[model samples]
Target: MHKFHLSIAALAGASVIALAAPVQAQDTAAQAPDAANSDIIVTAQRKQEKVTEVPISITVANQAQLERQQVNTMNDLNRIAPSLEIQQAPGQNTGGGGSIRGIGTQTFSAGAVASVGVVVDQVSQGNANISDLFDVSRIEVLKGPQGTLFGLTTSAGVINITTNAPDFHAFSARVRGELSDAGTAGSKFGNQVLQGVVNLPLASNAAIRVSGVANMRQGVNRNLTTGDLNDNDRYGVRARLLWEPADKLTVNLIGDYARARAENGGDFFTFIKTSTGVGSEIANCGLVAREGNQNYCTSQSYVGHTENYGGSLQIDYQAEPFTLTSITALRRSTETGYSAASNVFRADPLALQVANGPVNRHLSLFTQEFRISSPSDQFFEYTAGAFYSRQKQTRDPETLSVMLTLFPGMTIPLVDPATTGAGANDKIVDESLAFFGQGTFHLSPGLRLIAGGRYTTDRLSLDRYNYATAVASNTVLNVGNFSWKLGAQYDLARNAMVYATASRGFKGGQIATPSAPAVPFVVLPEIPTAYEAGLKTTLFGGWVADLSLFYQKIKDFQAQQCTVDSNSVISCVQRNIDGVKSRGAEINFFGKVFDGLSLNTGFIYAKATYPTGFVGTDGTVIGGTQLAYAPKYKFTLSGEYEVPVTSRFNGFLAVDTVWKSRIRYEANSRSETTFRPHWLVGGRIGVRTEDDRYSLSVFGRNLFNVHEPSLIQSDFPFGGAANIGAIYGPQSFRQVGLSFDAKF
Candidate 1:
């Protein structure tokens, strides 16, 4: 609480200083020649607009910014965007999840759906994976519900990624490579990346573009028994074709494929307890090991791999007053892996080891959309669209094993056997259809009224079979809902605006895999109503600042719950909390403080809590507790300076830092699952050709070498032990690297 107050006070002071400074009576259109701090263009409203002119809270990162920040994957985005939080899924490294403003999904089951949606090239992704960042044009992060414009309805927000399109008038090629080493004892060349892109003009009206990336990195964690574990080797390729057969018509086709082969990072046990008889045996296991130790052990090699491929076709036609667009897309992905319950192994007194059965999953998705929009220059502008999507997923049967050193000679059968295999094969299918429309009415030259709405219907079905018991079950759900948004914006002056908005968002309900015959198999949907007010301004003709305050009320919040049986086997279920409330404030600024220098800063303060009737798997009341992975306060500061060393060369330096308050890993809020506050610092220095055809640079990440755990989980007691055990996710290590780029 003290930290939160301090952060707020600091922001208030900065705001006061910024407002009190002498104002320059200059037009924003004729600002100083600071190309590095120019106005950012965004498409948050499904149309092109200046960031400062948009009513909602948003962040934009262009290709230059992404390269400077070294944001290659989803996890790396948090360094620049503090409100976005990401974590690796339990027992897996190749797949993970993210949340915006405390709304997200933590379960990896086929029945679960993510509250946050990820969109690439107008197509929604079924699952979150390591995204390849080669040949990307821009990334836009929307901070509120976007149900009315996007095909997928997510309660949280959306991440919109737009890749570079082919250019018909030019032929060009580029190559970039990087080499990095983990700054830790016994660490090797940990990260090596190579990427290339080429564009060829087939004719005056047609062009093709191709891009590929190769990435290899050594895992920071090690296994004493199996040398180097959790290493990464991945490759991806993308191709795009653009054709303009007529002056008023355009078409684009895109295809991409990616594959990864790697091992998941070993888990670190933060806490362990056993029966009193094995006191010395438990004392020998250490809590932390940089390389590997007996405490973190794996008898069999753990491996994970994934293959993903997708394609999309888009068409657009320009009319005198309106534009028509159509998009069709299909994607498929497959993943397989093995994970151990405990990374540590012991042979003495109470030797205990457990491993998860093989995991296999296959998923496919298809979507289509059609839209029409009026020109923005009109007094009344509007857009209307219809969207359809279908998805199917399958999970194969899996098994689990538990062994104890004390009972090595004893062979138990049935319930207490060394291995238990689940014969259940699960399948899930989902289909959705929606129609949405939005319009803006200009009351005056500087004031506008905006209204939008969406009508959606969804059908979900699940099938499960248990091989051991020969029990089969099927469930189906049909849901329909309406979401709407209303807002008004007024320009206080030509360079400043203030807006207010009220909106409603919805997520479809889900079915739970029955742990037993008596438990319920369905959970209700979630709905959140939000109200917000914001200010966007261009100050001093060279600085841009945006501030927003929002409040939300959620009913029937869906959350994941788990049960532990007498044999210590865990089963998952989804439940609905009665009520939850979230409120927050955000402030952002980007501008040139002086010639040849630029600065970007942001701050977020959020409080997300369950208001009533929230219970945990352990039968503990969790009312008034914070949501999982939601921190109270977050801040980021970054700056860069560039100077012309000569007419043909330029030198630059950049640095950034981020701070986050304490956060709980789960809704239960157990002491062992809490993560303390941490800070990270990173920087870069480089020299490049003035024309930007070639460059060389050096960069360092996690400069302070902070070892903060990204995730933690508590396990039920095994072997009749009174105390429970806990597992910790791998922490990112500090690294330094050099990179070079060439263009032709």
Candidate 2:
């Protein structure tokens, strides 16, 4: 079937399932109803507000929903939010990124800036690290441009995470642990997690909170050489302090540290022979192995380790009708890893012996911001802010080694003292300054107008040195840009609001490292303009629904291309495309269907394509093709039921299912690297004490053992005859687990 038709079928199926649930009559005799679908508070606009009151297309998940859904990491969010997708890069061990609304970074270069920004407690991070999700209170996903309010400029959207704050009048502690098995022979303790949090009142007006987590898991894939692959061992801790010296003055300090050491599931190859006379040297290897079977056959190991630490300070002061705030932060991250190159050379005789060397990277960043805002109750409320940030990154030297096994007992090195052990030392530094302001004017009692603008200046520098020849290259770039938003909103009724907005977002110009010395070193920035209209409504007293439609056009979209020269040396380059267009519609509904039953459903339909004149890396015309990782239709349906088991205990059950259409992994739209439509189901059943202090539950994820590939890559055209294979990462297998929680 055509891809478009498949998308339509999937959407139809999801709609039927969502609307067919029998709506049970409300039971007045039931106990206190479940509050899971109650009004949720979100900070999408840099201020607290009910999610139903926000004009943007936003999704908010609280602690209760997160626990019931078993969402432990950022990657798990795709199951609930259909507009987002996350995947690991094909060949790299420490380079993976995500996309929002069909727009994101296509390359894994350290110098490439992300279209989506991730913020934690008002502090922006350079990368989308999953460790920051530990012990989070709530997560809010905002769709569309957000440059006018946030310190970081994002063309796609923003993810805002808020952690629990210290309470001066409370002393509490909580602990939770989980243990799971993969339901396969030779697989023991597939997953384990232990987490704890403590809150204490140090003085009359001062308080402190601390949180820690330890997570470990065994691999889903078994390596023929090594025992297991894709294992995870991670630990993290966070501390926060709050002090209120006066009624109008408040200060907060936060620090966090996280470390991970594990073996990454590097790319596994499946051979594809283009020529018919190539003998039995190539065979069809499924992207994902069947149940109870290993997928990859390799001789070398792929391992990675990472360390991250950060701290931030915030101060707020209230003066009459205005408030002033300041935030200062610093962070550092280091990663080291290596992946074998044998997967790309499956057709050669010495394919199993080649391997790439270790890769090391370090990043350090500092940021500061100051802001002032008028009270929200005023007729003309306004906010203004200034931001400054500096970042430095370094890539350590790397080495490539080849092993020769001529005669079992005798082997010699085929090495040239100088060029055989070549490496590159690269460094990048960036500094940015921006000033932004937003204001809302009440045109009338039921109508409002909003306008905002931001101006940013960025300075970037790059230095590269070759160890073999002592050759060096240096480049610098400076650019300035402006972005703005215009919006209007109207209150139609007591429980309905409609809004429309048009916004522009910008990304800084980048310094591209080209293989050819004659090419320029700089690629201009990309800008996107988006127009959106949305409606939010609360119906039937407890049912909330939202609908949004958006259209975006991006100019000078960045694209990466690779070519093989006459000497068979591959050279990759980055350039700007003419333009791209994306239009989509999102629908969300959440509320209590009956006294003890709640339902949450989300659906997304998007069509993202490139304009005419777009070219692929292998000289193929890719005009009118779908963007990478952009699916046409996606949907999620989740339902939960809560009932009283006893006077002091409550029993609850939750089940959720997610479905996504086929997605292309590369711009060329090759069929071999496309992820077909798939579905996943998860559920939990448990009982908890009436006081909510103690609980136990049994849960299962991927209950049907679906074999789907998360990412797929084809190296047939880029590597010529030497590399003609496909690599992919399969989804996790079925897992069943039990969890225990306690509070004091």
Candidate 3:
């Protein structure tokens, strides 16, 4: 806690230093004319427009900035955007534990969908969302309800990712490699990354671009029982082809495959406390982690693997008065292996062994979209689109309980007993269709009125069979909703804009297949009504600043709640809460203050909670409780400065820091499920050529070795005192490495 307090002071000092440098920077402004570009083109509105000119709150990070900050995964992104939090829950290969403005899906059910959508290129992702940020052009984070333009999943917001397209005019290739070590703190060359991109010019009007990446890292936590934990290896390759079949038509074809494997690392387990007694565990948490061993299983090795592959095609044609576009995509994601953390909730385990049988899951998705747009220059500008999506999911039976043990008085692992047959198979299919449109009516040269809406229909079916009881469950549910937006934006000046909007967003109802006979097969959809106001402006040379305030109320909020019956049987499913409220303010600033110094900062003050008058069947009081993963306040700051050394080379330094208030992993506000406020800091120092053709740098992450978890849970099945389970962040330990980059 002291360290966290010190970090705040440190960041305050840094800000003071930054405030003091502008005066000196003004004197050297003439010598450093290459400042930041204040105006950046974006597709926030489904059409191209300057980011600051848009009426929504947004944060943009380009490839150079991402690489400079060493942001390679979803968790790393949370530090750059205060309003976003990516939690990779243990044993889950897919990216589902993510929230925008403290609203997201937290269930581990294979069929559950996230409220915050992730869009790659122009294709919306289902269960196959990519986990690695490899070879991307830029990322745009849009806050607030984007359902009118993004579709059913984006009730809260959207993470829009656009990769580099094939450059028909260029034939070039480049490769980058990085290696880092933490000595006794970590493995030798514990983290390594290699990635490359190649552009091939084919016919006169056609080209293809291929990019691939391989990243391997050793787990920072040690399993005092045996070897290190959470060792991971991931690799993937992406290929895109751009072809202009005719003078007025363009086509893009894309395909990619990626795979990740890890040992007892899929879940973060640190010893928080044990139900048994004190001095009993040094490190214990996450379902029941014991001292000295993160996974702490002696029976069978814990391992898991996840694979994702997909293909998409996009065609665009320019007509006389409008543009026509079509997008089609198919994606499949699979996970197979045993997850120790997954089973710990069903039984009191003497050691770590998730299930009696290997856990396997498969997800398939198909999407089609068509859109038409008129030029933005028109007085009445408009965009309209139709979208269709289908998803199929299946999970193999997992043996949740067994009597197998390695020792007499100790439960080391699982081995199914012949006397009992336990497990079940789950299958689900979901389909959705929607039509959406948005338009702007120009009232005058400096003012415009905007309106948009989406009409969607959804259907879901599920089948689950229990082996022991021979009980089968078959269910189907259908739902429909319409969401809309009303707003107005005004240009205060050439470099400033102000806007206010009232919007309604919808998240489709949820369906799940329980172990045997499903009690609640469907959950009603959630509807959020929101009012927001914001201002975007440019100041101090090329610096850009934005301030926004919002309030939202949601009815029938969906959340995952679990229970254990008297028979020692656990039933986990999606449940709808009475009401949810979110109100907050945000500030974002990015760009150069002057000369060679640049700063990027984002802060969020959000109060997300469930209102009073709501009680649980288990007698758990949750009235006025904050939602899980929703921190009351968060702040992120990063800065970089360039020092001119000579005509041929220059030296530079960069630093970043993130601080978040205390958060609970469960909406019930349980005492055991809490992560104290914490801070993370990173730095880099390097030398580069004046023309920027080549450069080398030394970087360090988690400079303070802050060990903090992104998620926490109660040891549900335990009998003694309250026990906590936690999964730490990706950069939980200190790591320093060397990096090299070249362009030719």
Top of the candidates by lDDT: 3
* Runs off by more than 4 Å, candidate 2: 1-38, 90-96, 184-189, 264-294, 297-302, 337-354, 401-421, 514-520, 561-572, 591-595, 716-731
Question: 119-200 in candidate 3: lDDT tens per residue?
Answer: 8888888777687787777778888889878854788888888787776665655556566643633422266776667677
How far residue 69's Cα lies from its native spot in candidate 1, in Å, is 1.3
Question: What is the Cα root-mean-square deviation between model 1 and the actual structure?
Answer: 9.4
Please give, for residues 346-431, the per-residue lDDT of candidate 2 as tens digits. Answer: 22333223334577878887989999989988789888999998888898766544444465666554422246545567798889
RMSD of 2: 8.9
Model 1 lDDT per residue over 1-744, tens place: 232234335434544543453432211112212233456677777777777888888766666667777777666767666667776545333223667777666664566666667788878775535356777777777877788888774677777777777776666667666666543322322676777777777999998989888776665544444544346677899999999999989999999999887664334343344445444444553323221121333445666777889999999899867899999999988878754342323222335544356668888889999999899987888889999988888888765555545465874333322223444678988889999998899889899999999999999888887664567878898999999999999999887999999999887777776533332277777888888899998766656788989898887877766545554555556678767777899888776656677777889988888777677545678888788778878887777788999999999898878898888766674665566787877878999888677788887777666655565444533442243444433234576777776665
Q: What lDDT would each prediction earn against the true structure?
A: 0.69, 0.69, 0.72
Candidate 1 lDDT: 0.69
Superposed by TM-score, candidate 2 places the C-alpha of residue 156 at a distance from the truth, in angstroms, of: 0.8
Most TM-score-accurate candidate: 3
Order the candidate numbers by TM-score, best to worst: 3, 1, 2
